[model samples]
Structure formats: C-alpha cells, structure tokens
Target: MSGEFGEEEQIEEQEGPAPSLAQIKHIILILSGKGGVGKSSVTTQAALTLCNMGYKVGVLDIDLTGPSLPRMFGLENRSIYQAAEGWLPVPVETNGVGSLSVISLGFLLGDRGNSVVWRGPKKTAMIKQFIKDVAWGQLDYLLIDTPPGTSDEHISIAEQLRFSEPDGAIVVTTPQSVATADVKKELNFCKKVALHILGVVENMSGFICPHCEECTNIFSSGGGLKLAEEFNVPYLGNVPIDPKFVELIENQTTADESLVESYGKSTLCPIFKDIMDKVLAQNRPARC
Candidate 1:
C-alpha cells in the first residue's frame, strides 16, 4: 500500500525534528486504515481529555484534502497568525485546568467549501510546512490527526518525525471485519516504519441510545480487539456512537464554554479517559 507513494520521503530534505516539536514532550498520531472510522473524533476527544487533565496540548490536522479539525473543535471561522517563531495556532478555550491549541489547513483556507486539489509533490510540500512551520510553544502532547491510509502525507510525517521520538500511534477502526482488514495494512505500515503502536481504539463499536443511554451492538463488536490481539498491541477500548457527542461537536455553545468543557459533561468522556489512561500508561506521564 505504501509503495504507491514512491520516494515520498524525498519531497523535502531530511532534517531533525521540527522547530515546534522540540518543546513538545510527547507526540501521538491518530491514524486509520480506512476513512470514516472517526479518527478525527478520537484525536479531538483525546486532546480534550488531556487538556481537562491539566496538560497543555496541540492538535495538527494533516488531512490535506479533507481537513476537518477546525470544525470539530468549533473554530471553523478562526485563522492562523504569523509570529516571530512561526505560524501561531488558533487556541481553543478550554475553560478548565488545561489548554488546547490547533493547527490545520482548514484554518488557512479562507472558504470552508474550498477544495485542496494538489499533486503528490504539492501535498508533500504543504505537509512539510505544517510540520516545520507551526509554532506550538511548550506542549505536553501534540496529537496529529492524519488522513486514512499510508500515503504522501503519512510518508512526509514519518520522515519529519524520525528524530522526534514520537510517543506512538493510536489506530482507530470500527468493530466491522472489513474495517479491521483494511487496518491490518496500517499496522504493517507502523511495523515497517518502526513506529510504536500505543493501542487500538474501536470507535463506533455500538450505538448509545440518547433516550435510554443503553449501548446496542449495531455494528457487531470485537473486530478491533481481534486486530489488536493479532497485532500484539493493547486494545484500548470500544467507543459507542453517542448522539450527544455529535451534538457537542456540531452545536454552537456560549463563549465561556469550549468543546473541552462541553465534553466533560458528555457520557463518553469517561470512556475516552480510560483509553487515554491506557495510552499515557505506556508513554511519558501526563500532568493532571
């Protein structure tokens, strides 16, 4: 699968860790073997969980063709700014014990409807700029939300972070056999690149009824766990589809309340906390 993007590492010169990454203690990539498995949602909840735990966090959305973190974090209208260090990421109002900041091509595009139509070389260049140019300042964690599959952007990120010693990757997938099959390629990609697999998250394993709050196995559960076991990685946990969580992402809240704040009240918050706990247990300790 990765062979399709031949010599993608040569898109930019090999260098040390990006300037912004130097001050970051840990970096975790949110990845998937296929799309629409809620990878971005995992990244968002992870960041919010860490922030609520009192850790400073940054999120970089590298899904060039379909950047959606800005909308997920409810900062769609926000724009990036240039400072002496580099591009200043838009800050999320945590309104809690921690802080959250974000950088994404979504912020750079003036129009939400704009499409990023570019060749492999162009996409690689933009990804390089995103990795090297953003000024994240000091952060406890930087969660990179990547496009599904192993492609140009993935190659570029792997090349750039070669020296950064990233914490690892949290692979997201549904509890469907097909999703797990595609995700096997992703696990293989991690092994080939020597990137550590922190764990596997089974997102949308079931549907949580908004009325009764009972979880129903709409998609049939256990595929994600089977994949993790087959790959010899930790199975973080299963995440049920919650309507309130979707509302939290889509509904506009008051200025004093941020996504993180709103998430604290959601039923899924504890589920993600357990997943993050399993992740942090393997990496550097996060502040709480």
Candidate 2:
C-alpha cells in the first residue's frame, strides 16, 4: 500500500479547500538541485532587496531539519507566538529593509543544537500545517527557501501553493557544468509539475579580489546562462563572490550588529537588485 496510493495519503486525498494565502500576494519558492550552492543566501538577499524596494516581504524557510535562516537573519533566539489562527512569525529587520515576518523550524525548537528527527510523512504533514498555521500578515511577496533537490519539501510547497499558482521558482546554481546538470533535472521537474519558473541565478560566478578589486572567473563561467538558454528559461543574472557577503555570513553568527548593518549595502546589493528586477518583471504579467 505504501508503493504509490497508500492509506497514509488520506489527508491529501480528502477534499478540502486549500488554506487561503490571501494575505501574501506573491510566493516565490527558491530551489537548487544540490546543497551548498548558496540557495538560501540568494533567497535571503532577494527577500531583503525586494523589501528594500518598499515591498512587504516574508521568508518561509522550509529547509525543515537544517534551517539556517534564523542565524542568517539574526533571529536565532527569536520565539514564536500564538495567533488567532496558529503560530505567528517574528519580524526581523536590518538597515531599514526587512521581512514583514519570517517562520522557520528553528524558532519552534528548544535549542539550536536540538535535532528535528522527522520522517517523510511527518515532515510533509508539518509543512502542510505550517502553511495553514503561520500568520504572515499582508505581504507583497513571500520567498520560500526549500531544501536542495526536487523532493518532499519542494513537493509540499508546490502542493500548498497550488491555488496561488505561484509567481514562479528561482533556481540557483553555480557556473559548474556538474551543478547545471543537476539543475536541469530540477527545472524539468518544475515543468512537469506545472510550476512556472522565474529564471535561474548564477551565484559565485566570479570572485572579486578584496584588495585589488578585480573580478576573476574562479569557477569557470557562463554555465548558468548557458543552461537557461538550453532550457529556454530566462537567465536572471549572476552574483560575484564578494568579501562583503562573506562578512555578512561571519557577523551573522558572532552577533556583530553594527558591521552587519553596514554590510547591508554590501557590493551584492546592486547585483541582487538587477536579478530582482528580472524577477519582478516576470512576476508582473502573471496573477491567479
């Protein structure tokens, strides 16, 4: 019975209206075929940039067991609250640009080191419940950072946001052919599931020397744009490796608020803005 249509899928099989995400206008799920490709970074940067543009943005970290957003946005000690519906998210702000709210599995845990030992059924069910429970007030955009690969987490988000039809997913990748190969399958999976793709972003495409301030292709180049052309999806843009972004990561863990705020206008800001422009451009003509 567990082969395909099993008894455990009764929750999904039952006829029920999807939760109303009416408060959030656009939901963009960010994915990568493999981990360590900086998908979460891109997701956070995009959310911050969009919020900077005067849009109310919320980030839903669906990474589940390995949630990094709490530390990434400096909300490690944040707590969740009770809402009329369910648990409410804690708003995190930085340099006047921030999310309306953010919800991560980290906030619900007792300690940062505590493990979330959830299996498939339980994890997917939690995803469903979180979608129904989180009280993300009126938001212009909600960026969902998914665990790498086209698996349960990705499927859960797609199913939950089916009614909204999502603005689209932004795939992140490196300039390596190996990464692009995996991303190709991820792109096809999205196509098969009928999720529109905003486009693909090449991260760490080039490295900028902190001293010389010169850009160099450290991971080869053009693979992301090439893959987009091959798949006929838009090539959003690329982000070069910057020391400022590195500082952002380091300060996130050490609680260096002053340095973190100053780095908000890091070199990555301009690059992220260019990519978000393409995302908004594509997001505009579509609405469900």
Candidate 3:
C-alpha cells in the first residue's frame, strides 16, 4: 500500500505546476499529416466558430517553426504582455466577440521572415512552458495547432498531457493521396498514444469559383471520408475554398467588418460549422 501510495505521489510531482489545466474544460489538438493543407486556417476558423457558439476558446499555436496564428487572427504586430499570473495570451476578437485568447511563437519572432531553428529538447521545453506558464484562465476549449507531421512535438504533447488526457485530436488533410497517406500515419500515432480521435476534417475539400459559383475539384475530393471509413472514425465535415477567406487572413486584420461579413457568408464557414456540429453532437461530454 505504501509503495502504491508513493507512486501516486511521484506522479503528482511529475505533473509539476499547472499539471492539469483545471480552468480549461476540454483540450483538443488539430494536427495534419503535412503542412500547406490549410491546417492553420482550419484551426483558426474552428476556434472562431466555437466562439460564435458562445464558448470561451483559446488557441495555442504549437507550430513553433511556422507559427501563423498571429497573422491568421489578424494579430500581427501584437506582443505578449506579462501579467501577475503568467504570460498573457493575445486575445482574438471574432465578430466583435473576443471570446478567444491565442498564443504563438510567431508573436515572439523578431521579424516576419525570421526562422525558428531549435533542436528537439529546446522545442519540447518551449511546449512544456506553454502548457505550464501561460495564464489560460477559465476556458471552454483550448485548441492546439500542432506542427505538420508527427515527430518530437507530437510525442511531447501526448506524454505531457497523458494525465490531462486531452479530449481528442482532429486530423486535417486534403483530398489527395499524398496527404491522405500521411494522415494515416497521423491516425496511427494517435492510436499508439491512446488519444481519442474526435474526427477527421477535410479542408479545401472543393473550390467554388467566385464569379460563376461553380464547384471545381481542384484538389480532388473524398479522400478524407475514405480514410475516416478505413479507420472507423467519424467524418467531421469538409470546407470549400473561397477567395474572400483567403483575403481575410492574408490581410491580417478583422477590423474589416465587410470582409468579416463576406467571410462569414463564405462557403467554408457553414461547412466548418457542420463539422463542429458533428463534434458537438458526437462528443457532448467534450463540452463539459
């Protein structure tokens, strides 16, 4: 009995400071097999959608190398200020609702073009600090944006949050074989680590032309659903590409209410909401 009790104590010690984010109800990760599949964009929009649903959300851009949340949320030139609690995350206002707070290595970069070159240990330490030191107050959901492909970053997150047992991970992929093949590897990674998979999200599933509104199979379609079927996981939903959305993020500002108005009307918006609808319906407990 003493030995078992001692082991429990050791685990408590290992969890360290802020072991389990008590204030945050659910923690979810957004991962992709490879980059440039709009993983970051999807993550940002999902966070916004959740916020619009009246949930307090926070986004941790763990893609340290290519942290884009600063720009994606139109928070460029913003800096992280120190609070009495810890490092305060930059807040993102979505449709006049600033229900989201965000943190990213991009905000720490000296310049837009600067690079982050770090060994595995350094990167792991940074992730640990982000989990421990950030002042992430009460939150309904904390969406983590992981770097492309599974590597040291993936291992660190899975093990670090082993106790927290993140609600699950959302795998993002394009409708192409090259991306789907890697997504399979990503799914295997989640399984090996015992992380529940909420579902698979197919981004840029199709493209709708602005002029004629004709749908185009630019990147092909159905690969994500097929992969989900093979793995027996839920297919969240698919988001179509719209030029207005491209301009929204590329412009790096949400001050454009017209752009915001147009973006909310974009094809991707509703598709993303449908994906979240599946998520909320299937995992009602995640909301708690």
* Model 2 TM-score (2 dp): 0.88
Name the regions of candidate 2 deviating beyond 4 angstroms. 1-17, 94-99, 252-264, 283-288
**By summed lDDT, which 10 consecutive residues of candidate 3 come out lowest?**
7-16
**Per-residue C-alpha lDDT of model 1 across residues 132-215, encoded as one tens digit per residue:** 888988999999999988878888888888877888999999998988988999999898788989999999888867689787
Residue pairs clashing, model 3: none
- By TM-score, the best candidate is 1
Residue 149 alpha-carbon offset, candidate 3, angstroms: 1.2
Best by lDDT: 1
lDDT of 2 by residue, 9-45 (tens): 2213323434546667788889889788898899878
Shift of residue 267 alpha carbon in model 2, Å: 1.3
Model 1, backbone clash pairs (residues 3+ apart or across chains), number = 0
Evaluate model 1: give its TM-score.
Answer: 0.92
Top-down TM-score ranking: 1, 3, 2
TM-score preference between candidates 1 and 3, better one? 1
When superposed on Cα atoms, how far off is each prediction in RMSD?
2.8, 3.6, 5.8
lDDT rank order: 1, 3, 2
